[model samples]
Target: MSPLVADELAQWAQYIQSATGIYLDGSKGYLIETRFAPLLKEVGTTSFGELLRRTQVDTTGALRRKVVDAITTNETSFFRDNSPFELLQHKLIPDLIDTRNRSTGAVRPIPIRIWSAACSTGQEVYSIAMLFHELKVDLKRFDVRIFGTDISDRALAAASRGTFAKMEIDRGLPLDRLGRYFATDGQTYRVKDEIRAMATFRSINLLEPFTFPHKFDLVLCRNVAIYFTERDKARLFGSIARVMAPDGTLLIGSTETITGICPQFEPKRHVRSVFYSLKVNGS
Candidate 1:
């Protein structure tokens, strides 16, 4: 590909994101060609520039969704990084439980709410379920609700299925955990029915609104905003701040730190990964 073609693809991605709130990460033109080339060829389009022109003129909305889904990175796996899970299992959960118990006295265990934003393929959310199960908490006793949301409907549907191929099941998942939590079915593995039912998956447009039906005690939106420009990052964190409860914890990807982007949250250092606590929010 020539430099000019790459540059035009980048521009088109920027336009798509700015117009439709779906980020393309600029480096994902290969994804566009890989996924859309067939459609483009089927439609008799020859080049990326021509495809872009067709997308602009065509208001049928099919091309837009296809492009966005193709370009959206759905890279995720079970127990993605051991350290973050460790921190959640050890540090954050204990602190959150104690704080909730002290704040709300009428219950045996206080309710805990969590959101896994940009949760691709549902592994991260399942990881959380395993942690709680390991803690020996009767899931029925404590009101625990986990919401896994992604911009891609395709991924959300897969997540809702609570099933994985052998390779995908093996990736980042320990053998013992897999054996206990998943049942082998022909060529694939499926999460236990009880564990799978603990989380709900949905399609969410994060750029549209900061409104969540309910405020969460913790939000894990890691690895989702790394490619956004500085200004977009600022807007994203601002939107997150709106939906977050005061004192709620926010975990981000290891490579991403909202230090300069969001000053309202206080950085809390943990052995696994640094998390930000909402010292203040849209009050």
Candidate 2:
């Protein structure tokens, strides 16, 4: 891997940030050098400069997606943060059930939906499914749905399979849950059939045009939005708001909150952490 040429650097910078919301700052040179070196070699490109030119100039468009896919970071784990799930288990679900039961409407379970936007692998989606299962809650009554989407077809393809490497399974996932929900296969652990059946995976780009099939009871747009520009992030949240049911809760990453950036949500305390709840227009 030769050092990227000046024009190569600029083309890659603009191409990546425009296509994906990842803004490459100064240290990005090393990322390109280190992470994508093997990709260039695999493509039989002699230098980063040539690969960059092909991606920037290719009318074929295949090279462009491959480059973008290579650069996209897909780091995640099960129950990455535990507080929100604790709140969901102890407080939110019980209160929601009580509230719904009080209504003199249908004597049936309500539609419960969750959207994990940019759900990288199956871990987070499976984590939620495992959460419900731990509660010993029967899914026979409720219309439970979890929608996991990512821009990368490659990522979504892996996620939909519900398989994890031993390292991935060891990371943050509890032993008790693992024993119950997974089956060992050499170096890998596959999520049990029951958990895999609970969630649906699809390919979606936060930057491009797309629509949610239905309004959700909960939306977890988590750590993924930190990549977007302020304008893009605002637009992203606003579009998200269109599909968020007025009373449904949206869980963002602990580090990334809508405060100042997105004003549609009202801050509320749950499990000693701050979360944004859907707000009623002050009227």
Error of 2 at 282 (Å): 7.9
Cand. 1 TM to true fold:
0.88
Q: Give the lowest summed-lDDT range of ten residues in model 1.
A: 1-10
Candidate 2 residue-wise lDDT, 48-73, digit = tens: 87887777778988877777678888
Clashes of each: 0, 0
Assess the local accuracy of residue 50 in candidate 2 as a C-alpha lDDT between 0 and 100: 80
Runs in model 2 lying further than 4 Å from the true structure: 56-61, 101-109
Query: What are the TM-scores, per candidate, against the unseen true structure?
Result: 0.88, 0.91
Tell me, by lDDT, which candidate is best. Answer: 2
Residue pairs with colliding backbones in model 2 are none
Q: How does candidate 2 fare on TM-score?
A: 0.91
| Alpha carbon lDDT of each predicted model | 0.78, 0.80
lDDT, model 2, position 15 = 75
